[model samples]
Target chain A: MDPVREVEGRAYPFGLKNVDTDIIIPAHWLKTISREGLGEGAFEALRKDENNVFDRPEFAGAPIIVAGDNFGCGSSREHAAWALLDMGVKAVIAPSFSDIFSGNAFKNGILTVALPQEAIDRLMEVAETDPISIDLENQTVTTPFQDRFTFEIDPFRKHCLMEGLDEVGLTLERDSAIAGYEARQTGEMPWYAKGTALSA
Target chain B: MASKPRTLYEKIWDAHLVERREDGTCLIYIDRHLVHEVTSPQAFEALRLSGRKVRRPELTLAVPDHNLPTTARLDEKGHRIPIADPQSAQQLAALESNAPEFGIRYFGATDIHQGIVHVVGPELGFSLPGATIVCGDSHTSCHGGIGALAFGIGTSEVEHVLASQTLLLTQSKTMEVRVEGELSPGVTPKDLILHIIGTIGTAGGTGHVIEYRGKVFEEMSIEGRLTVCNMSIEGGARAGLVAPDEKTFAYLKGREYAPKGEDWDRAVAYWKTLKTDEGASFDKSVVIDAATVEPTVTWGTSPEDTVSIGGEVPAPESFADPSKQKAAQASLNYMGLQPGQKMSDIEVQNVFIGSCTNSRIEDLRAAAEVLKGRSKAPGVKWAIVVPGSGLVKKQAEEEGLDKIFIEAGLEWREPGCSACLGMNPDKVPPEERCASTSNRNFVGRQGPGARTHLVSPAMAAAAAVTGKLTDVRELR
Candidate 1:
């Protein structure tokens, strides 16, 4: 993961609400073992339409998406996140986001900005013809038209996005603490460590 | 001095907390990690590239469900048949190799133990009361029915859990979805949850864990509770929990992985204390009258686009918000539905009576009961019943449910998540509508351009018989 401090570009002004992961990337595209080359399949269903905004020359390869409320609302397939990154979506600005999708996006260094619908309405307007800029460090989304809207994010996630921290590696540093907890659990609740040995 | 009365979620959260950071993020230990073919191949690849082994292989279980064909897997000579789709074959092959390489136990594609991860977990007692379970698939919330703190994770988090048993997390707020009153006959748990989701909308439980409370849930069978909890993701909750009770213990008593002898008694003692303390506070709450819930079905692409069997399709203009109105119009277009059309008047070409949501033995029995002495209507082109697992299929066979289904003109197929997401060969053809017992009604979930109307098992059977959506109550 790369440090993601700022994402500034023309945003795909797709304001469809409840855009689920299935729409982001369908199940057929999920068979690949690798994460690369998913850009071709990103929004494959919507992209089938010749006039879809994603395929429009102005929004092609845009690094941001301005969507309606409850964006990325179904399925836990991280392929949705990987597909977005593969297609160069660095930030998604929505009024709200589903919890799992938001977490997946944060993990992949994609910034998710939640602002009031009024701010989103303004962003959607500016996104039609102008570039939108998101600053993770300052927790703000700004437009070239001098419009600035602030957002909220977990402080830890912000730090992680800025630093490009490897979460698993960091947790491995606390290996001793985990081992200690396991030791305690073994004594207190020994049944947990008993593996599910199926009877023949 | 008395401690603060805590919710069941808080109690489980406290028990699993390993460390809390200054930023308010906590490292919580995952007790069980379930892996499947689709979301796990990439995670294993990442692990191999990073030269990291599974931190706790004993705690992990892998099975190939998604991308697996529910068709016959063996030849007459008892040789294994190859998967038709090359990409799917490779994905399944990767898990077959990765599990053994990482020292994790895997139920192979043809193993009697192999099935949907959610169904396999509780049936084998791999999921237990008060455990924290994580899986790459969203329906992992189904394990919460057994009183676990379970939620779905993405491939990145799947890799994280593989490399380390703990995950960096923030605590979720608690919500109580309390349902009172007795459920009317023929109103299944699937209908109850669909009605709940219709009331609360898809984003209703976002950022919170829901604890189902009151008499309705208490009387529901473990399978019924599992069906309700399975769609918690569709409702936007991270997980849904029902506190462990005597029924939960009874359901687990002699299962393969449940504690034994003295351990069983001790486990039960601990599980009994897993309930919410009286007067515990919830961040939010919603109450539903169970008797009011009807046999429900979805009318549009989204799960929230649901109505009772007797209700009419809502007009797009009926929505107050312009965005919603636009969405509703699009959904109606995709679903080929007209406003004011009765739900029962809509015809379906396909009927799928299986998924992690409703593929257990109980669900099969319910559908079989409806299909007995009946056959598929002439207009219904395809109808199939896929059990959740091999064991579930065996149990259904022993009970002669397969005969009932076959006699009624529905294909009694092998076990896998067939036609649910259409990763396999089973799929509802484009532009065709299906009455599905699966969780999601999202566009293309059953296949590209496939219109899915989510319904319960019995309701799906009813549709199969009538070749249209029919209220099960009216079938009698």
Candidate 2:
């Protein structure tokens, strides 16, 4: 979980709408136990086209994806986020996102920027030729063409993404409080605290 | 003056709030966490790498359902049938080893208690009223039917819950769907939910937790309630609940994980108060006449792309939005359907009657009732019935549902999420259309290039016998 203050690179100009988790990475590819090397299978169906934008040399190693409204609509598989990160997608700019997908992306240090559809259209146009830059500190996406668009993100999520603090890190911050709760739980609800009692 | 009345969602949500953060997010205590094979391996691996053990293994339960083959594990001589695919084998193996290592209850491939995570949790009484539950699968909302505040979480959140037993969540808006009046015979909960999803597109319930109410839901059986809540994800809702009632308590009373004796009375007293207060308001409210909802089926790639069995496919020109028209056209092309074609006239090559959505004992009975004396059509190549769990399978067998299915020429198989996503051996061939009782009619969802039409179990059974998406009422 490396800190990400900014993401500066050419973005894949695919603004496809209703692009589901199944399309991001097919179910067959989810069979693997490992999360690594998933980029090869990322967008496997769309990549079947010889002239697919993902295969385009210009957008290779792009750190951003400008997607359409309601992106990542189906499934709670975290592999969708993992696949994007594997393919170097550090941020996704869209009009809206599936809440589960947004949470997954934030947990993995990927920024999901929700902007107006007009802003997304402008960004899509800018992404065609110039590199796009995202400044988490300023909450704006800028293009080499001097186009700028602002976005809103929950402050807590923004802080976590910028500082690379995952849920594990946050939980550890409250270790003492958690321990105290567990001690009380063991005393009050012994049946719930005992692993043997629950397994039955 | 009276305080502001809160919706059922608000009441349950407020009860679970442990801490309110400065960022307007709150930490909610998670009473139960469900895990399956497909999404949890990486989460467990992350925990291993970080050298953190499960904080409360007692609260977490792991099961392998997505990757398990829907066939008997033991053969004639008690020899185990081999898992052909290495990937599926590895995932099940990972769960078998990981659960014990992590000290969580593991229902493995051979465990009779093993089934779809969503089905087994409620069947075994793990999901309870007024509890905050999370799982790594979207259909975790199925538990909310029993009045729990439940929704899906990602693998990362699964790990978070494993380490802390709490989740940081921004509160969700509340939606009320009140379906009044009586349902016509042959109109099941599956049809009702499909109608709701079709009325409110796939993204309609986005960011809202829906509480289903009114006379129709109150009269529904627990299984019916579960079926309705199971597809809440299909309607784009974060979760859907039907508040705890007598039917819910009756269903859970004797289950293994249910509280007993004095604890039972206390639990019931608490659950009795889980309903919405009188005159409580919601962020959004919609009412439907349950009697008006006919037997429904999806005609396109999305769950919202649905229509009544007696209706014609939607013409792209009918849509005002160009994007929706384009999407409808795309769906028509992929489904090999014409815009004006009647849904019942479109033939299907396969029929699947199982999934977390509609694979309970009652679901099996509904399909069996339709197929009792009927035979599958000659054009139908394959028809399969996979129960939600071993318990469901045993119940169906005891009721002679398996005999009915077999006599009707439909294959009765073991329990697991077979043919739902084609992770197992069962799959609809490419370019073929299937009438499936499973959720999700996405193109290539059952298999690559496969077309799926979502329908109720009875509708699927009718289709199996007719070779098309026929209305179950007509068949009855």
Candidate 3:
């Protein structure tokens, strides 16, 4: 599923640190409990402000968001990821991301690119002027001014994103290995081997 | 080759090993999977798209907390705070849909049994000793209060645990936090832990699993042990542990999920040996005197920046390190308190006496005793008392603690993460300072620009009446 070419997108910049899931999408929005319509709640509190980052006219319809370090530091709410995706954030450029938040982003087709502080600062500047292009196949982000920065992603996530595969898809690819393991473990750990492996 | 006698960690770990990696991390089989509504949706989807079934459905349990509203059917039409935050509702929907599909137990809103996952896990005996339990919530470590090797996992790990009841993890080093002597009368486990964090400076136990030992822990109630372990993360420890004893067995003896019949006898016998051996050495050791700990409150953003009830707020220059001094000054300005003001005299706008931190029945009772006949200040907007668990909530109601909160003009609500950072419905307004019993007072965690002063339940209750950080010792 690894692509020979790169995937690219526009840069939507959000320059906030310690941006928690609660802020990404408030909890009260969780009533219907469906993933749909979550994008509306993305940055609900911030959107409430007249001058919030998401409401900036200059950054309208931007795809890539360049953010500060420690972005998404609190809560394990995946809706934060869903809402961001629905809002058209294809990739997030940041100094760092909260571990759980980053994983959720990657699984949901949003690329969480970790760049050095200098790289983020430069990207933020470039994003304000024009859109940035990220070639996932090439593992590089490029601007018209010839500024280029390469980012690394886990090979597994890279493969999935290239193929639009989720974690379930990735695991499905390993069916043969899983089946083989189950067969082997049946005798190794009988407690897990009862009936069909499905029950175990 | 001779090996050391196995501790509970060794026994459970050895029993669950599926494979050992060259790097020394074991592919450890997880025995129990407890999840909250907030973190399970993505994992559930991963399971669905992969066409995988739960490795053990019966072993997994789910509950809606974190983001469930304290006031359902609340009006949002021109309300100050949005009545419904759509994202949390969606997350809840995902759980409501998937739990039944996967055959996992789902406890939702006001369900006589719905509460904080960790609180309910033990009360129902779902968190047994010598078990490997994984939850996406960081406070999952609260289960470690009963000698379980429970740890918080990421969303990806949550997916892993769902598809397969196992994780590949490196074993952690053990750190023993010994709290000795009897606690001072007004001093509780909440103060004891805040004192530990204040002394240890937040990152003291990073990368190590802390086992709280000594007389203070032994004498502490189960609810108290939970409060202590709940904040272990504040000190940066992965989790906290307490070896199971008669107290642990007594708490679990007749719980809903506890082993019945002869299995009960065997489970207790096995649990007794879960403790560390006399000669067993730990990677690190720290000891504190319980009698010396007083009512504590955080003076800065981090949990470590705490002082005693009667102590004056620290001046920036009091910190010798230049960077710390600067940060202290910055925090003081952000909190809007004078550097030299008496710690016990800072005014607060609200009083929050619950959360996973100190929302047990005993915690409510402790707070209610102080608020029994007293009413809070009129201008204080909210006095939130969200219980930690349905069982605890029921117990408190039976004891009329709910009436006490009501009589004091406080709002008595059902269990949920109410004002805790896990969600944001019942939050403090920006720039408003409040006394809270929850762990962590990171900038604006209570709400956007809301200031939180972390204190014990007793102190938080006292502040409810006086509208300031009054000493709980004075109330007595």
Candidate 4:
């Protein structure tokens, strides 16, 4: 995965609240074995209306989604994040996010930026006619009209994102410590070992 | 000197902390990781591509539930089987192939232990007190009933745990919810939780881990506790936990994975200390009168859109928040309900009694008790019961719960998360309203354009009999 220092593009001006994973990508679309091409199914229900923003040609490759509060509120489906990424959504501006969904988005290199509702409202307006830019390095979101909003993020997450480090890569960095712990665990709890204790 | 107070969540959380990072986040080791067919395939594929193996395969268990078809035929060796849906077949096949490749244990559809990941973990003793558990499914919080620090994770987190056996995390603030008094007859744990969700709204528990206390939770049966903890996500909580007691120990004793002989005594000694100490504090607190909770049902698109069975549908204007008001109007339109319409007057074409939330043996017995010698209403088109696990199915059948449901015109089917997710053949037709025992009422959660009314198993059974969302207490 490439480092995501900044994302600059027109954002989908959708400000709908509690836009759940179901609305992001319906359960039926989750049936496919491959993760590729989910963009076609992204917002499948909303895109049915010809006038919907997802189908609007101007925002076709928008790299950001400016949504309302409690975005991604249902289901632990990573498909929601996959759909967003496939649709080229590099960052989501919302009042808040469901922790599980935010975690999923983070792992997939989609930045979830939480701002106050007023800030989200302002962004929603700016996104309607202007492009938006997000700088993860500075923790600030800006619009072509000079609307600037600074946000707070866990510094560790920001570091990982800028460094293009995933959990696996992070863990492998501490491989020696993990190996030591595993050896101790095996010795102390032999009953909990796989084949010896429970039939798998 | 006075000691600083700590919640049960903090105590457990602090115990599992491996390292505190410079950025206010910590690395916490995971005791157990559960995997399912739907969310894990992509994670496993990522691992394969990266050439990384599971760090601790023994600690992870895999099962197929969400996309499983419950009405499949038996094969030559007496294994219940179905794979007609090509996509479902491929997903399950991927899990089967991937589990062995990574040395993670896979329980296929044919295995008796194969069930909903949450249910199988507890019934088979994989979830234990003081353990930190996670899964790719949100309802993984269900194991917190055993006093474990359990919550859901995304597929990437699943891959992270598989590769490192730990999650890098930021902790959540703690909220305490105390339910006082005794529940009214015919009201179950499901009613209590739905009542709480309705009171708090869907996002009320955001950024917090909720601890359910008071006499009601203490007195609740193990299965009832599981039912309550399973829906914590619907309340927008990262997780919900109950301090384990004797009932918890009794439920685990002698189970397949539970400690044995001398280890049992030592384990119980430690589990007994897994509670919030006296004078401990929470960031927030709420109190619910158990008597106020009735046979609850959701009448809208979200779990928070719920009310007592006898109550009237709330008008959108009743909500103080404008966004909530708009959401309520949309929900009312989608649910095909009118403001001020009594919940009891709304009709339902189907009654589905199964999900990770309410598909256990006790849930089956509750519905069976209501359906005994009673036939479904003539207006009801489809009434079905899908068990959570094969063992639960076998237990229900042995106790004649299946016979009662079958006699009542409700189809008693095999074990899996069937109509709950609608990933398989079982589905509610478009525009048809259903009284469901599932946790979610999200639009199209059951099927496209299918309206869902979240109700308890007993109420769903009663609805099957009366063809509307009738209060079980009235029938009693």
User: Best-fitting candidate, measured by lDDT?
Assistant: 1
Off by over 4 Å in 2: A179-200, B1-3
Best first by lDDT, ranked: 1, 4, 2, 3
lDDT of each: 0.93, 0.87, 0.75, 0.87
Predicted structure with the largest DockQ when compared to the true one: 1
* lDDT by residue (tens digit), candidate 4, A101-193: 998898888999999999988988888888999999999998878789999988878888898986678767876766665566456543333
Second chain alone, TM-score for each candidate: 0.99, 0.98, 0.95, 0.98
Displacement of residue B163 (Cα, Å) in model 4 is: 1.2
TM-score of each: 0.99, 0.97, 0.78, 0.97
DockQ of 2: 0.55
Q: List all candidate RMSDs to the true structure.
A: 1.0, 1.8, 6.2, 1.8
Please report, as a residue range, the 10-residue window in candidate 2 chain B with the lowest summed lDDT.
Answer: B254-263
lDDT against true structure, model 1: 0.93
lDDT of 1 by residue, A1-200 (tens): 79999999999999889999999999999999998888889999898899899989988789999999999988999999999999999999999999899999999999999999999899889989999999888899999889989899999999889999988889999999999889999899887876644342
Q: For candidate 2, write residues A1-200 as lDDT tens digits.
A: 78889999899988887788888988888888887778988999789889888999999899999988788888988899999999989999988888888889898888999898888888888888989999999998998878888888899888887777766767668777667666764564333343324433
True lDDT of residue B354, candidate 3: 80
- Clashing residue pairs, backbone N/CA/C < 3 A, model 1: none
Better of 3 and 4 by lDDT: 4
lDDT of 1 by residue, B1-476 (tens): 99999999999999999999999999999989999999998899989998998988988999899888888899999999999889999999999999999998999988999999999999999899999999999989999999999999999999999998889999999999999899998899999999999989899999999999999989999999999999998899989999999999999998888888888898899999999999899999999998899999999989998899999999999999898899999999999899999999999999999999999999999999999999999999999999999999999999999999999999988889999996999999999999999999888999988999999999999999999999998888
Model 1 CA deviation exceeding 4 Å by range: A197-200
